[model samples]
Target: MDLVIGRSRSAAARRRREVAERRTRAIAAAAGVTTGAVLVAEVLRVWRRGDAPLPGETEDVVLAAEQAIGQTVEVAVAGYKGGSTRENALLNLHLSFLATFVLTRVSTRLLRERGRWGPLRNVVVGDHHIHHFVPGIAMAFLAGGVSIVSRDEDLDPYLAVPFGAGVALTLDESALLLKLDDVYWSEEGIVSVQITLATLAMLSALALALRVLRRGEAEVLEHDHEIGHGMPGMVVPVPSFP
Candidate 1:
């Protein structure tokens, strides 16, 4: 009877473990979907509507976009349009971080579960095991430094790519960073996942709040332009909101 009881307990425990894993995966998938949707929407907005005013360019594109998206959505778009270069740079930084967080978690799961089925599992350099974080870190620093010294609007997206990748790699080994030891295969690895999610959530909320708060100002300025009171032939340089 004791042996039978032990067997039953083990089976029950296994089911519970499976359920927990499924729940975690579900949450991660949801986060990934949400992040991808936001990124796609932002990119589509830029492609379809163009960017904020550049030097020697008029604000017509921004105005048109605002009109197309309507008041609620337009307010945020307008606020972004009127934002300064520094604001745009900060936005790029936030997006890169968020993207990295999502991608790292998802990729780690995929590689762990499906590694044997694909060539992805064989990636290496000679006898040394290549860690994605190494290249990610190098790219991030290189691009980040370049962005800091220069204000080229076009460079922001380029910088975001490397920075995001670097962040993902580094965060995947978040346990190592905190404890100075490799605990990636242990429960401690989840620390990186938690930090990534928390940071992304906070940054996203802050960005949304800033945009929402700027709505009234954006509307007022837009109203001035509509009434023909806005400055004509004056070019205000601003970064793209993406």
Candidate 2:
């Protein structure tokens, strides 16, 4: 009887902690959105006052970025089909963003209604609704920081998890960020869905264009394969990029 009682107490305590975590995450999300608004306002205020720093001043601020990241940037650039680091990063960021959006939509649909068992139950903490974006935001920063310092390309896939998660969470709160109020279930909340869909469409279009361009380049190379032969029975391998 004592053992059963102890187990019950532990479970109760764990439930309380989970409830507290959900509340904490909700508060943090609110604070983050508020802080972002204030920062944007500050930047606009400075710009209007003509107090913004010069373009060169901004360059100096990030001048040490290359030195700080060391060879990570080079490795990313080299791996990106011979594309520049900026291009590679942007492409991956968009792809991850779209993926996160799709995931959030599916998970939200599945977890909106409660169940007695399975992973969907994990979405709710006590009576409080826990957003997946909360964990996503944390993971994104943790993984991004690790990827920045590591030179291994194999670890790059791990970096996508956080980026994708954080993005989904942020996009779901898009209405909150824009209106500075909670309107997630109302008509206003629909704005978040619209924005997420539009962004994904644009990113998909860009990715398709890039693929077509790559295919065209490959076809051009194939034509050259026959013309570039120097000797009979000699085989040459084409170089691969990215």
Candidate 3:
């Protein structure tokens, strides 16, 4: 009887530990997927859309997509024709997205190089508090920094809404240590809320990429000799994003 009881207790403890691990993994996995997808999306958005107005590019996304991604089921959603100047606003949205990607990339680098200057993690940055508060917050600021440009892209900020919200929520959730996720571990889990948020974040990041490329092009045009290698449009300046 004593042997059986001890084994049972041990099994329960093991099960508890497994449960905690799954939650952690769920959050981290969500962040990773979000980040990667954002990167890809930003790359494409910038490639196609080009630059936006500075100092307010981000606002366009918020005005358009704020808290909206979760609300939309049909991929067609809104956000296509953002404002009175819908075309311009869309361009700015793309610009803000490009800048966001640059910032996210910067945060990733900090995780690697500035980990000591910031927080400590168990092989994963998102698992750490500093990752949430410091790097995550910085990225959030980039996301929140919007303008008429962003506002102009007023139709929908689908990617920005959920992506920003998810990062903020996940960071908070980690801090609170919510033991809500127990089933999404080491398996092909369902397309959860976290998953959707991550997708939105990825698309936003992709938009940022396009903005940066467009900005780089403008710079190259001003000083053509400085940049030795780039395509023709690579150096052409895009009008201030809508």
TM-score of each: 0.55, 0.46, 0.26
lDDT string, candidate 2, 201-231, tens digits? 4446356435433443344333334466544
Q: Highest lDDT among the candidates is held by which one?
A: 1
Candidate 1 residue pairs in backbone clash: none
lDDT of each residue in 80-176, candidate 3, tens digit only: 2222343433444444444444344345446557664245332455654333334545555555554323764443454354335435434433423
**Model 1 lDDT at residue 63:** 67
Candidate 1 runs further than 4 Å off: 1-74, 116-122, 148-161, 177-182, 195-213, 220-242
Top candidate on TM-score is 1
Q: Give the TM-score of candidate 2.
A: 0.46
Show the lowest summed lDDT stretch of 10 residues, model 1: 46-55
- Cα lDDT tens digits for candidate 1, 101-171: 66666676688788743445636788976666676778778887887889687677557666766766666
Query: What residue runs in model 3 are displaced by over 4 Å at the alpha carbon?
Result: 1-16, 19-171, 174-203, 218-242
lDDT at 26, model 1? 73
